[model samples]
Target: MRSDYFKNTAYVRKTAVSSSIQKLDKKDDELAFAKFFIERLNQFRKLNYRVVSSDEESSGADIYATAENLETLNLQLKTGEPGLERFWGRRRKLGSGMGIIDVNIEDLLAQIIRDSEKHYANKENLTLLITERYQPVFDKNYALRISTMFGNSSFKGIYIVKLPSFRASFPYEGQIVAIKDIFGNHGEVF
Candidate 1:
């Protein structure tokens, strides 16, 4: 009985450690993405900005950025292609050899709008930053479509940061598109 108790305690300890490690890994990923996002935005817009401490992240914003001559902005960062899990599930059921998986941009936009409405309602100075790691294309059509979805969103801006796969040669830092501009107009790429 004592041996079983010891084993259970050990298992609990291992599980706790594993959970802590996972949390740390997630935090690390968020910090790395925030740094990359800020650097790219600064380069493109010629603005100086710094990410606020992680402790401030509990306010429903993944990141908080501060810049001179600008209001402190609350950034909700989402990574990964929206609806990617469903795509993978479909591919698996079809037996794997499916050539060229295409992500549905409309579905992605709809998901973002839903997330914005759910999480950021009545929040001022909030921006939705989606880091699409698998989107193959970020073009004018995508910008316009994304912008159209946010006609009544509470978010001040919606930006998609397209980080290409390891195969792309140009735009090593990836691309940024303003789906909805803070100034209340259709967005443009930086």
Candidate 2:
């Protein structure tokens, strides 16, 4: 089942890339990512949650999730790049001696905040799901920083899902860090 999940994720990612190159809409990608995110959430929290795509235009939520509690959570999904394109060009370079790659977490947070404000109209009961496309180094401190940064935001919860490298055999072997949640908790979900 786990292997099948990874294979499905890989296929969704490939489709997302192809759609991107074709300048087509990424509705399928958004739904697939939402489902994947919910699956991980369910596994980590031991909660049976199901996700469905929302009419973003009317609901201001990319996806909606519901659990046994009958409580619905609106999620605003955002995918971000590692901001390493400038160094490696369009195609990412894989090899040794790549040197240190600096990732500005503050800038990324700022962008997320901006995107949330610009794209979402209703923020009540809304959770932010940011899926980092490439592998970016994030420690507990960074997670704390993220929590602190979005603490006062309109979102009820905020989470970051960092994906593994493209070459990784276990694509789902990544971290899901919660920046903020209903219980006022923060840290790695795993």
Candidate 3:
């Protein structure tokens, strides 16, 4: 329910972060998603941000963008069950660049939050979560609570973009981008 402080959390609270979901096994999805995100950011047509691949032990931020020598971090990726049908009742809250939020999103959200906490603690330079397309497990519960807490900014906190499911195995195809549609329009956030 805390908006302004969602990104600002006490150090004690940050040390206690954990998750149980398996590491994302699909690199194709990772690259595809990262590619799209990078392209989109680059398309902004301003100063360009640099994208860096994972290296040994450095633990550098994922995608770092810069303007006028000012660098920013972007942690864009997927979360929880690939099949979005699992989203039933959940809520998402957004805050400014430096804030603290007490809500949990998905498995990926947990990891991102945890990692960001670590990075910030180490005095690294990183900003912006850009966690759009977050699909909550429930609607009314989190929605009502988030609405009550955030009011007008509630919508800005989350962008419920429609995501099609990804198929693990496709025997009859060379390559395909699998997507599951709720109304067959490929599930755009309504």
Candidate 4:
């Protein structure tokens, strides 16, 4: 059975999304990715989440959503490959032996902190969702790093949506690798 969300019959052709992504300059990629992500996210009708538009100047999250049993979620979307070095602390280049397809969990957390402090100060929870062009193989290790790093913050989760390629045949997919309940429970699955 094709239980994966991205495997839905009605899906965006990898070519369409990739070609579109390739044509965009860096400035517009965030918004473009946000739009694309939201469209795919809304497919889960059972979840009853409504994806709302956000204005860059005033919105803390790239996309906003409302659902039962939780406060408004601030989904701060980030794109591009994670850098080779951690933002703070010891600097070490990620060598090819470790693989180039990865997202820097530390840097992403820093951004979430900055964005949440500035715009999501009053919000209940924060999630940093990154959509990468290449498939990353380190989500499990990265999740453990995040849990150990920011175990006290209200930042509840980090999700990765990987779009393998723009070849029109590849499928776009995602998964919530790590999550916690700000209310006390750890590793809550969504």
Best by TM-score: 1
Clashing pairs in 1: none
RMSD of each: 4.2, 11.0, 16.5, 14.1
Regions of candidate 4 where Cα sits further than 4 Å from its true position? 1-46, 68-70, 80-120, 123-125, 139-142, 164-172, 179-190
lDDT: which is higher, 1 or 3? 1
C-alpha lDDT (0 to 100) for residue 5 of candidate 2: 100
Candidate numbers sorted by lDDT from highest down: 2, 1, 4, 3
Span of ten consecutive residues with least summed lDDT in model 4: 83-92
Model 4 C-alpha lDDT per residue in residues 21-125, reported as the tens digit of each score: 775555366555555544545453234555665675886666677767746666776653553223212222333433433345566655654565565564445
Per-residue lDDT over 1-190 for candidate 1, one digit per residue giving the tens place of the 0 to 100 score:
9999999999999999999999888777676666766777788678888988446435867778899888777777776464754665676678762345454555767686686677665555677777665434556665676667664667777777765346555334467777777655565665
Q: Whose TM-score is higher: candidate 1's or candidate 2's?
A: 1
Cα TM-score per model: 0.76, 0.70, 0.35, 0.48
Off by over 4 Å in 2: 1-25, 82-103, 164-172
Question: What lDDT, from 0 to 1, does candidate 4 have?
Answer: 0.52
CA error at residue 128 for candidate 2, angstroms: 1.2
Q: Which ten residues in a row have the lowest lDDT in candidate 3?
A: 173-182
lDDT of 3 by residue, 32-101 (tens): 4454444444553344655555532565344333445644443333334342222322222232322232
lDDT of each: 0.69, 0.70, 0.35, 0.52
Q: Model 4 compared with the native: what TM-score? A: 0.48
The CA root-mean-square deviation of candidate 2, after full C-alpha superposition on the true structure, stands at: 11.0
